[model samples]
Target: MTLREFMVQRQPALCERWLDLLLADYGEETAANWRRERDPFANPIGHTFTTEAPRLVEAVSGDGKFDTVAAAALEAIIKIRSVQELAPSRAIAFVYMLRDVIRGELGTELARGAHATALATVDRRIERLALLAFDVYVRCREQVFRLRQDELKRSVASLLRRWHGSELPEPASEEVVHLSPPPNHAVRR
Candidate 1:
């Protein structure tokens, strides 16, 4: 069988292995808890892993074109990691871990020359996924940093007001633009 065929046949097992490796990074107890809790509301990170990992596996092994749904899934996972304050390397390591999962699953089939082209295709697709994930990770980290910066600004402003017993005046502008729409505008159906 072709590598893609094999990958499709093995996708569920591959995704589970990928998720297991991912949860392993969280330590044994948390991993077990995540594994056991199937409810998305109760265990969102675990839910994301269970739901999205399969999409990722299918994306890698199917048409090889990473689609928007897969990108969004990657974002969901990355956003969680970014908020958790993991180092960028740790946050994005799951993407790289998929490579090992696929390699391990393929085993001797990869060593045999039968599906070398298909294997290369899968590797290339995986590389593209990793690059996309890095982009998502960088964006998420930037957002987290911006949030922290904004919080710091708010805290300092609050402290200043409490210490000085006055609210800071809003910035004065010479010309203000009103954003309200005209009252005489016609209503459209």
Candidate 2:
């Protein structure tokens, strides 16, 4: 199923997890404040991570599915961090803002006396947002990987230069080298 459909289907569980995390971070009082600000918008979306994102992540540790969701959330968080230099709490707040927008626009009934149409419209919108969020997450991850790879290359090059060894090959110019398989030993008699 699509990510949006999966999230919607598992909304209740996810929300519970998210709530647990929020409470842990901000304590009951801060969680209550978050609920006041966020719960209203969460109703229509069928799921939310407002207070529960971190809690859900903790619950999913070592479980593959939860790890996947956490990875996506992390990537998105990283992108926001790189661009805005936000503190972790502030970055999470921005995630809530985006979630609110999705919930508000995609969870609303559109037009009068057309419930089916409204549902379809909302589904489409949610799917779109899911795609956008996923893309943002991927792009952020790719950028991070590129940065690390570049740093590693630079380090290796510097070490080689310091040793006064033969010039190291350019990372980009090096092709992926695969070893050939050994010849088969058994033959029909």
Query: How accurate locally, in lDDT, is each candidate?
Result: 0.75, 0.43
TM-score of 1: 0.77
Cα error of candidate 2 at position 120, Å: 1.7
lDDT of model 1 at residue 27?
A: 92
Going through the candidates in the order shown, the clash numbers are: 0, 5
**lDDT, candidate 1, at 45:** 91
TM-score for all predictions?
Answer: 0.77, 0.31
Candidate 1 clashing pairs, residues 3+ apart or interchain: none
lDDT, candidate 1, 24-60, per-residue tens: 8889999999999989999999998899888888887
Q: Which lDDT value does model 1 have at 37?
A: 95
lDDT of 2 at 52: 33
lDDT of 2 by residue, 56-127 (tens): 333222222233444444443345444444454443443344344334433432225434443444444334
Return the lDDT, model 1, position 179: 18
Distance (Å) between predicted and true CA of 161, model 1? 14
